[model samples]
Target chain A: MKVNAKKVLMLTKISKSYQNNLVINNFSLDFNYGDSVGIIGKNGSGKSTILKISCGLLKPDSGNVLLMGKSFDSTEDGLLIKSRMGVVLHEDMLYPQLTVFENLNFYSKILGIKNVNTKIEELSTLLNLSDYLKISVSKLSNGNKKRVSFAKSLLNDPDILFADEPESNLDDNGKEIVSKIFNDRRKRGLTNFFSTHSEIFLEKCSNQLINLKDFENA
Target chain B: MLNWFKVLSILIKKDIKIEFQTKETLVTLCLFGLLIITVFSLSTENNSLINQNFGAGILWSSVIFAGSIAMVKFFYHEEQNKTLQSLLVMPVPSELILFSKSIVFFIFLSISEIIIFLISSVLFNLNIFSLKLILGCIVFNIGYSVVGSFFGVISSKSSSKEILLTMLLIPIITPILMFIIATTNDVIRSELNSNFQTWLGLGISFDIIFLTLMSYLFGKILED
Candidate 1:
């Protein structure tokens, strides 16, 4: 395969399986900066698996994943690449015992974001999380928890964000805020890679779409 | 380098903070440890010889059992909450995650040890406060925390995690368990100078080797 140094993310012939069942078979994709890519598929169709593999959360049995011209093969390079990326998976991935502000603060510290308070405040406002900042995550509704998770992914103003079902558990207003966030990220030339069942959400946030149903038949 | 330390400290702080808020691990460890000590003490009542010979065994066994139970509770929350997954996607090195957890577990184990020892001293009339015993515990705790934290994450992936953690942890830590028991026996019997250096050296060696080996393996186990 010819290498593209400028591609923001590249997955070459990626294959993954579980217990002799192949979920993603020799799938390949190239994502560039500022491109909002949406992956749609039925349940068990490997939408989340591909996002997990691309973010280095899960490893593929075969093929290579490159982010910003760097691969996950090298530990140092993997850490560097991950530092520039953000991910929101099916789980909220927040400490339920901690308040929303504390959860965001903890993540911001790990991401090495300076001016932590200001950035958290800004995101909280954008996500309508200002009132719920001091509330424990466990006390929040699913929509609020998703908002907090969304805020966390943007804590570092990451170069790329990978989210699975970004609209799950979100209300109409919460979905609109998420749409706006993606739009703003796109305007700033940041990439978004997400999986969703919502056709309207996919259309609003994604300029490029990959239907895994096609890959399954092939 | 500085950023690495900053991140490590942050992770450690987070674990400690949550632990304090819930007191889940510490309380469970202390209660379970004390129960073991109480049973052993009651069974060996008025038998000084049995107490002299078996006090260390009772103490260290309690430590092992309690530590394992506490580790299960500790990592269960990390798995249930998917916080460990969150950390994996960040710039933090996987080894650092292991190291930070080991440190936090070390702290919790140490605190529980202090309490168990004090209670054991009273119930079993054993001299657990000696310099030699304390040093031995320091070595053993370091080894336990490193090995336990490593296996804790592995077992956390399973459905029968509580049993899996203990099954994986006990066999691996048998050598350290023997070392501490032997040294604690020497300390309790006032035979402090009897091959003390040799056993201490062995304990320290086990700690360093496992800490290095487990740190390397932890990163690999966490992948995919």
Candidate 2:
């Protein structure tokens, strides 16, 4: 199969399973620059698994994942691809012991962002996390924790963002803020690959939709 | 290379900061180790010869068991909150994650060892301090931390993580445990045992071999 070097993300014949239970089988998709793709499916439809594999968080049993035309086969390539991508999963992935600002600051340094404080400040204000910046994540409510996770994912202004259930546990205003961020990313020609159960969120953020049920048993 | 060091330092600093906030790992390590020492001290109170002959064994058994328990607690938060998944998505090399955790564990282990050793000296009535013993501790700590960190992450995925981590860790680190016990014995006796260098060599070799092998394996394990 000839690879498309211009595509932003590509998954060719991906298959994943847990023990004898298969989740995703021979699944394939292509995402390009400026595309906002949202996947909708039932609770066990492997939406999170697809996003995880696409972001290199989980290895597919049989498949090739190409991000920015580079595969995760080589460590060097994997790092290069990861540097340009961001992910938000069901778990907040923030240290409960660290304050909101500290968590963002730590991740910024890992991403080698030069102006870490400025980036954190901007994100905090945008996500209405400015007031909670000094608060430990463990002390925050579920909605606020979700906002912080969003801010962390956007710290790098990644070329592609992979979010699993990006709006879960969020209030209406919080969902609006996230929808706006996704819309803005699409307008700026960045890519977003996300899974959501809300049709409202899907209409507001995604230009392309994938129903995992259609690919069942394929 | 410079970038790698910068990222490593950031990870290490983050871990240290979290540890300070909770004091969970250090407190667990020190308390558990001290408890073991206290138990042995009470049981062997009547036998000075037992204390003299098996002080090294007693100290290390405490360190090993307590270290395993503490390591389980250390990685539990990473797995529970999915913070490790957060780091895995970043550009940081997986080995750096292993190294950072190992370094942080090494620091905590060293601090706990100091407290445990002091209490053991008073309880066993033996001089537990010497340059040779310190050297042996450093080498042994490196090997233990690296191997423990590797198995710690692996076992954190299991339902019975506490049991699995101890089961996996103790067997892999047997050589280092033996080396440290032998060196501590020589230090206590205040005589250079004929095989002192040989023991030191074994400890050093274990550190180097596992550090290299585990660093490589850590990446593969995380990928799965």
Candidate 3:
């Protein structure tokens, strides 16, 4: 006997462009539970844009994004789907003037997570950021800030995690931690989608590979 | 609804905490306000009637300009680190984000206004110690902060944020400015005239309308 995975996210007939050039044209993909995908492309490719549009950050010129069988049509719809998804874009998205503790604590409160301190401590320890919790984000190194950003995204234990260039500005140990986190989430029947240029990182984290060049150039 | 208030409180608290640490907006607002009050006091020192008649105008004009500076600075951190994107991705509604920013900016503006009020009262011998004046100031701040925060987010995304904020802010807020100036004149004169109630009513109405309108518009503008 074999178990069947349900479709968790679907992007259909998606097309996006900037100025006059087409970035993503008629692009579509269906992701099932426990599926991990890595989008690969050149710098000007629409990999990040695709991730953004799928997560409701950037709207596609013409397409529909369906999450758990619901369409992104209204504010309420977007909010409902977004709450179940976590995103880490290229930017750290942490307040520079605030400490790591403060940043994570604030997000936890907004996420309505109970026992926030315990959650912060657990994630910080896993990311090797236990000692930097009290330091301001501005004073942290790029790798440390990246780790903090990663920790912030996992605070809610999202079912779907979308990361744009997840391995950027990270040391080998940091990358290993991120890869391990991805594997852990996948083992728990969650889904992960990320865009990266590193083949090795993609192999370690993603089970499905999407070369965005094939979509954009075709 | 309960969750909305909780998220609103968290957003406001986060902004206040960051501001307390950096003090960038506070310093700019206070220093700019002080400079305006100083310039006006010196310019009107020799003229008794002008000082008495136009002192309220001078004080409010200073606040309007200085408060805009603070509003722009308030959104600077969010743009710098892309924290606005973080907030938008949360479970919270976009309208609540605008409301929180407006509330935080209002508190900051009110604090600076108190300092401006004290300094102007001493320098220009202004008798601006009336209950109606206090209430009017609250109404004026509400209108300014709501509209200013809305435009501030837009301008902060532009290449020329400071100029863009002023250009978008001043014209839209003209009616509110007139209402405040009229109410301030009555306070400065220490006499409630026939038009005092009318101006105060206008100011309150402006606050209500813009606050509601801006809160709705903020969600739409931010989503785009």
Candidate 4:
């Protein structure tokens, strides 16, 4: 279970199916240090499903996923692994009942964060969630909620950050804000895998792109 | 100490915010709590016998019933909004999440109990100042809500969430209710000679048994 940066993550012939629908067939991927990968596919191409399987949210029918040589046995184990990784899936992963400040407070505490008051302040300013901190999340626009999810994913500053359709619900400034965060993360040597419908984000942000023009682009 | 406490407090804040803003769950419980108090007050207003005999039962049953409504509604709100899924994803001990939420339900239940306790005490002229009797009520309540939360999470994921919580919660929590009422009546009626010990023992046992069971099983509940 001692996964150093030298050996990040490995997936060999990863496949997933549910009740006979094969989401991904014979999919293989690898993550090295400082790697920024874009997973591009059309709708129903099992893009998000691949991310879920890697994080242990979805069960792959066959094949293996290795993170620093440790195998993720099940979905629960995936969450354990994912606890060390920041993931922003296409879904909205936030509680609207909580204010922006309270949402960060709760998540940072759960992350066992210390200096979290400072951390929250930093995140708020970086993402511009300051004015909305005390307001109920129920009143926040969709864009703000997505920013909350993004900030939460950075709570632990994991070695890897997964962004699923991170650019879908943002204005020009929000996109710039995210791009800056991505670059800062890159400087810190964090591995990032972005899954999207197009490679626009990759061309604009990632140093390299993958699987954009074809089904297999490793 | 600070971490879990902070989690507990944040969870409480979130629940109170939701309650105050929408007034959906607690408001409904408050209306029902008032009706139960009204009916019991009217029925007992004219007769001393009914008032003395069934007053504690009436008060406790109203609390138990109203508490169930709120307990079940708590889960319903989470289900409708997908909030539970987000909470589950947090990297914390599963029991902490369960207990933090159970504490919220406990607060709602305690509030309902206090509201009814105040109303019924004035109407029936019952004693609310006895330390031992009040402690017994609190003890019973702790177990009641703890067990209620365990089963509430269970029913919330099932087919008939609201209906199943009542059906399942009643049978599971019967022992806690019996002990609470028995202990309450023992204190109020001044009937037992050597009996303070038995009531005290039952209260402690009820708290211990259910709290342990809840913490033990909450992990599996989250996985489900």
Better of 2 and 4 by DockQ: 2
True contacts kept of each: 0.81, 0.89, 0.70, 0.27
What candidate 4 gets wrong by more than 4 Å, as runs, is A10-29, A40-46, A56-83, A112-118, A128-131, A202-218, B1-28, B157-160, B193-203
Q: Provide the TM-score of chain A alone for each candidate, in the order shown.
A: 0.96, 0.97, 0.95, 0.90
Judging by DockQ, tell me the better candidate of 3 and 4. Answer: 3
Docking quality category of candidate 2 according to DockQ thresholds:
medium
Write one digit per residue (lDDT tens) for candidate 4, span B65-177: 77777777777767666566566555445576678777777777777667777777787787654776678767877887788888887887777777888898888777777
For every model shown, what is its TM-score relative to the native structure? 0.98, 0.97, 0.96, 0.81
Clashing pairs in 2: none
- Model 1: per-residue lDDT, tens digit, B1-224? 12778989999999998887889999999999999999888899848899898888888889899999999998999999999999999899999999999999999999999999998888887766888888998999999999999999989979999999999999988888888989888988888368878888889999999999998888888895
Better of 1 and 2 by lDDT: 2
- Model 2: reference contacts kept, as a fraction: 0.89
Which residue segments of model 1 deviate by more than 4 Å? A1-4
- Give me the displacement of residue A128 in model 3, in angstroms: 0.5
Residues A74-134 of candidate 2: C-alpha lDDT, one tens digit per residue: 9988888888888999999999999998999999988888789999999999999999999
- Residue clash pairs of candidate 1: none
Which rank order by TM-score, best down to worst? 1, 2, 3, 4
